[model samples]
Structure formats: structure tokens, C-alpha cells
Target: MGILALQGAFIEHTKMLHRLGVDSFEIRQKKDLLLPMDGIILPGGESTTMFKLLNDLDMTTTIKELIQNGLPTFGTCAGMLLLAKTVDNYHSDFLGTMNIAVKKNAYGRQLGSFRTTGTFASTQNVPFVFIRAPHVTEYGDTVEVLSIVNDKIVAVREHNQLATAFHPELTTDTSIHQYFIDMCQQ
Candidate 1:
């Protein structure tokens, strides 16, 4: 497994994966991507900063290739923004793998960060932490909305890719991380 360490909450995701007994490492540069990665997690942070780093590190092409070739990927918050097909205000498309349009920081600023318990798809009582998170404004037919809060789409799954607007790694629940792991195993 690999976590994009250019920015954001990569450490939190790494810790969650460790607790699940899954050996994972950080992908800090293009060289790091040389290591075999079955799955990758894009953590939450500033989308514009992540975008700049992806290009600065010259990793946009290879990372997109990996995901396009069916690497199971889980993105949270800014991760979600990067994978989105279209962003309302952002001019560039980071990955644009999923066919979803999102509004960056639709939940407001850092002060808007909050916790809520919502069902993840058919499951119940999953904890979510939203901090300047983006929500799906619209999705294509193939995209399945997994969770919604305040009537806004927060989580979605498309084939080998899974994305969440909230920071699932910030919470104690491991189901979402486990769910991504299972996807990788398949």
C-alpha cells in the first residue's frame, strides 16, 4: 500500500493502516512510486498545494496511470477533490478519474470542522470528521454515493476507486479503511 505524502494527513492514514496490520509506506517523490503499490490513499489537505506538488514532483502522470490501470485507491477530503472529474471553481483537474463534480470546501473553512455519525452505504454508525471538506455536487451513473450528511454527498465508490469528503482516518472506526483494503485484495 502507498500513501501520497506530499502533503495532508498522510500520517493518520498510515497509522490507521498499521492498526489494520497492513504494511504501507509513503510516496514522497517519483522514486517512491517505483515501489510496488497495490493500493494508494490520497489524504486530506489543501487541494491547490497538492496539485502543485504533484506536478512539481512530476508524479501526476504515473500516479494517474496506476489508478487508471485499476489500482484500488481511497481518497479523503482534498484527496476527493483531486480525484474528482470536475471541480466548480478549480481550473485544473488533478486526477479526474471519477465522474463526479465537487465544490471544494463546500462545508466552509477550518472552523466548520465537525463530527457526525452516519451510515456508510448499508452499514450503520460510522464516524466522520469533516474539515474544510468538499462534497459531491453531482455524480455520473456509474458512481455510487456511499454516504450523505446534511443532504450532501460525502462518500462515493467507482470501480476500484473510493473517495470520501470527510476524514475517516481521524476517527477510530476502521471499516472504511478496511473496506478499501478488501477492495485491494480483490
Candidate 2:
């Protein structure tokens, strides 16, 4: 598996994936992205900056292609925003492959950042850190809601794609990463 290492807590994500026994590599450039792979995780970062970098490197089209071809992908925080079909306050130039409407910075701002506990698939009371996170307002029929907060959708899975508004790598839990790996295996 490969992880987008453009920004955010990518190192933490790599560490967690390593702990999960998944041989993962950091994808810094478009050349680093290999096809016919198992999965890819887009780490959280500045959404606008990441989008610009991907465009500059000509990776935007390729990423959409891979996702459309049924490559399993996991996106977190800003990553989730990139995968959304629509994002409020941001230009409509994202990947738009997840078929979900997202509200950027749904939690407000940095001062509004906070942590909470919630039940994940196999983990209970998982510590989720929300930093300028996006919330799903609507999803397509193929999307599966995984978790919610204050009645807002926070996590979702659609076919080979998985997304979370919270930073699971910021916590010590490995269940979520493991779950992604399991999905890749299947």
C-alpha cells in the first residue's frame, strides 16, 4: 500500500500502518503512485495546497482514474474533503469521486478544534481529533455510514473507498488502519 505524503500527519499514518503490519510507502510525487496495487491512503493536510500540488504534478487525473478503477482508498480530514463531490466555501475542483457533499471546517476553526470519543467499527470510544474537519451533509446510495457525531456523518465507506473526518492517526489506536488493510485484502 501507498500513503499520500504531501502534508499533514503523514509520518504518524506511516507509523500506524507499520504497526498494523502493512508494508506501506510514502507517495510524494506522481511517479511514486503505482497501479494494480491494493490500497492508498490520502493523509490529512491543507486541502487547497494539496490540490494545487497534485495538479502541478499532474497527479489529479491519475488519482481519479485509480479510484474509478476500483482501487481501495482511505482519506482522512482534508483527504476526506478532497474525495467529496462537493465542498462548501471551496471551489468545485476536488477529486469528486466519493459522491458525498462536505462542509469544510464544519467544526468552525482552529480554536474550535476538539477531541471526542465514539464507537468505530471494532473500536469503542475511539479518540477522534477534529482539526478544521469536514462533515458529510449527504452521501449517495452506495455510501455506507460508519460513524457520526452530533448527528453529522463523520466516517463513510463506498466500495473501495473509505473516509473519515477525524484524524485516527493522531490517536494510538490501530483498529481503523487495520480495518482498511482488511478491506484491501478482500
Candidate 3:
């Protein structure tokens, strides 16, 4: 597994994957993309900065190619924004591979961050940490709603791509990570 280490809460994702006995490394530079990876995690952070850094390192094209070519991807928060086909009131050249329309920080600002135990599809009552989360307001025909909280879509899966508006790594939950691992194995 590979975690985009340009910025954000990537370390937590690294630790979460480690707990699941999954080996993961950081993708900080364009050369890092050369490494063999079964899947990639785009952790929560500042999307604009991450996008800028990706272009500065000239890594966006290769990463997008990898994801577009059917590599499994799990994006959380800002990662969701990057993977989104359209982010309301925002634009960038990041990985717009997922066929979902995301509302930028749909849950509001950092002060609005909160936590809740919600149903994530079959994985019922999973712990969700919403820190300036961006719930999927709409998705294409192929996209599946994996979870929802207060009627807001928090998790979605589209083909080989998976995205969550909340941070699963911030909590003790390992099922979400396991779900992504299963995706990689498939």
C-alpha cells in the first residue's frame, strides 16, 4: 500500500494500516510512484496545498494514471475532494477519477468538526471522525453509498475507488482499513 505523504494526516493512516498487518510507505516525490503498490490512501488534509505540491513535484499525472487504470484507492476527507469529479466552489488538476460530486467541506469548518457512530453500509455502527469533512452530495450511477450520517453521505465506493468524508484512522476502528485491504486483495 502507498500513502500520499505530501501533507495531511498520513501518519495516522500509516499506523492504522500497520495495525492491520499491512505494509505501507509514503509517496512524497514523483520517484516514489515507481514503487509497486497494490493500493493508495489519500488522507485528510488541506486539498489546495496537496494539489499544489503534487503539481510542483510533477506527480499528479502518474498517480492519476495509476488510479484511472484500476488501482484501488481509498480517499479520506481532502483525499475525497481530490478523487472527486467535481468539488463545488473548487477546481484543481488532482485525481478526478471518482464519478462523484463533492461539496467542499460540506460539514462546515474545523470548528464544526465532530464525531459520531454511524452506519457505513454493511459495516454497521462504525466509528466516524468528521474533521471538516466533505460528504458526497451526489454520485453517478455506478457509485455506491457505503455510509451516511444525518442523511449526509459519508462514504462511497465507485468501482475500484473508495472514498470517505470522515477520518477512520483517527479512531480505534480497524474495519474500514480492513475493507480497503480487502479491496486491494481483490
Best by lDDT: 1
Better of 2 and 3 by TM-score: 3
Question: What residue runs in model 1 are displaced by over 4 Å at the alpha carbon?
Answer: none
Show the colliding residue pairs in model 2.
none
For model 3, how does the per-residue alpha-carbon lDDT over 11-80 read when each residue is reduced to its tens digit? Answer: 9999999998999999999999889999999999999999999999999899999998999999999999
What global local distance difference test value does model 3 have? Answer: 0.91
Q: Candidates sorted by lDDT, descending order? A: 1, 3, 2
Report the C-alpha lDDT of model 2 over 92-141, residue by residue, as the tens digit. Answer: 68899998999999999899899999977657888889998999999999
- Give the per-residue lDDT of model 1 (tens digit) for 86-135: 99977886889988999988978789889999999788999999998899
For residue 140, model 2's alpha carbon misses the true position, in angstroms, by 0.8
Candidate number that wins on lDDT, 2 or 3: 3
lDDT for model 2, on a 0 to 1 scale?
Answer: 0.89
Residue 80 shift from truth in candidate 1, angstroms: 0.2
TM-score of 1: 0.98
Q: Give the lowest summed-lDDT range of ten residues in model 1.
A: 89-98
Each model's lDDT comes to 0.93, 0.89, 0.91
RMSD of each: 0.8, 1.2, 0.9
TM-score of each: 0.98, 0.96, 0.97
TM-score of 3: 0.97
